[model samples]
Target: MVGRKKRTTICDKELQKEDLISNLHEPLISEILLRLSTKDAVRTSLLSKRWRYLWQTVPGLDLALYDFLNINFSNIDAFFKFVERFFDSHRESWIRKLRLYLGYRHHICGLKSWIDAVTRPKIQHLDVNYYSSDEIPVSIYTCETLVHLRLEWVSLPNTEFVSLPCLKIMHLKRIRFTSDTTLEKLISGSPVLEDLKLFGCSNHNAIQLRSHTLKKIDMDMDHSSGFVIDAPLLQCLKTKIASTKDFQIISSGFPAKLDIDLQWRRRRPLERPPKKVIRDILADIRRVSDLVITSDILKEFFLYSKSRTVRQFRNLSRLHARFAICDIEMLPALLESCTKLESLIMVI
Candidate 1:
């Protein structure tokens, strides 16, 4: 009888330790629950009475409906409903970040409403990927507190007036702009933007990027167009151009890095780019320290060297060239121009 009493006493001590742990305050408990998926987070309420209302206060929401891709119609409908309920149950006054990745669908009104509801003043990061060709709601542009924004496969709103006072990083992929001036106006609105990336964007004749605060610019486009860069503070630049009609550089701070790839369509072979074209491009970025030039571009540069004067790349230290054996004749002239080149890479 005495041994049975001792066992009961030890069991009571273990239960007491568990009670102390489960009784942690809501903020601490919410942190533990926030790492879980939204569905799993919500399901925590069923664990015990102490956790019943704790999941509702999580500060961030990460909802990914990847299963929506393979699920049946009824399941998709149910999944959306579940999302609605989750949002309705969420009671956090300030959400730190919200991410949504969804497949192609025509749920415009629902998406607009959801965006309007979640884009509060406290939201700092917003990422949305909708594989459909729907136009993004203008409400996102008014997110004054957003620090980072990423959007894919969406058309930007056609609003002349845009203001993002705190945005710093913006990435757009497969985005459609309403007009030529749309991109310019959008960049102008973000007074303090630092990094910008554009990939596979459509519906623009030319992109004139003029910014004093931009530090990095990356662009990959399939269309034949030109770029006008005036970012004096830019440190890194990467671009893939389909045609070499014109690439104007007004001004840039150097000791930078440049990666350039130029390709010509097979059906329409472009005439050799003008000697002045190559000279102007090389002269503007002459201060770059690292450079990569593909075989096709080097061929044009080689042809240009035969006619025009080759400018010196005094600050260039590393050069990477992808060239054919026939283009080897240009290497002497190219290497002579780089007075300080320390490393050379020749890829066949």
Candidate 2:
């Protein structure tokens, strides 16, 4: 038995091509193939001639400023041409999302054709955030594929009308409204919208809203004359106001009652309120259950009470005063008087 020993050795060569093929032919590997970014997808071209086609098949393409910080902006025409070539190389017919965030002065004459080319009907999500030369393109109003729109520091034409039928949500910040009617028409057309946010926008013109599906709205019309809101199914309303002069709120469908923060300051020396101004303001939100009042408004409320009998908040369940320094003692009695109020939050 000792004389019949056998020799064993290991081979250092790689596995055969057929054995490696089985590992590459996987469902998880196929998904990873589809989700590769533009840069990473190009690397796969060196893997093999067969892998070169995978780069063109990937459907997603995102070009933001952070992706190319060192890009030469002085030669804007050349930079865009290179990006266009890259986009044209991708053979995907349908893109799920396209985001363009290039910090350049958006001239209408040069940008119009480029914008029209990218807004294919197949694109479901399109986010275009660009700083313009104080002007917004006209094609934005007629884009029918957008589901969500976010605009900041953009100047839209007064005559331009936005009539996106498929739009579900809109957020406008620091956008100068051209005319009151333009804004009104936009809100009226977007019936399927569920959420809307307006920050630092002037609303001097009359506004009308009629949405069957709208649920939440957060408006910050600070330091400007306010506008009117008339939404039927709006559930939550949160607002911030730095100036209270001529702050008119004419809401007919006083929402499902979520959270209300109302603050009115008396920085302007007004002798007295109009006969029925402030009373009408409080009456509009009489049905809201939760109320959050700031210091200035609380002082006005107590001062108005001293002059005449103002209706106590009967439906309010919770009262929160953010900074109640001198008016801390009156708050406990105010909370107990409201038959429905269960708790009070005060910070002196």
TM-score winner: 1
Residue-pair clash count for candidate 2: 0
- What is the lDDT for 204 in model 1? 45
lDDT per residue for candidate 2 within 258-340, as digits (tens), equals 44344433445555444355455465447677776665555566666633323457777776767656767666556554677
lDDT of 1 at 218: 82
TM-score of each: 0.74, 0.66
Clashes of each: 0, 0
Candidate 1 structure quality by residue, lDDT tens digits, 1-348 = 999999999999999998886888888888887777666777788878888878778876766676443542255667677667766766546776777777565353467677777675567878888875567778887788888888888778688787888889999888877777778877888989999998888644767888888888888865636778888888888777654534566773552788887655343475655555566666745757888878777666656664332554556798888888877787787777777889999898
Residue pairs with clashing backbones, model 1: none
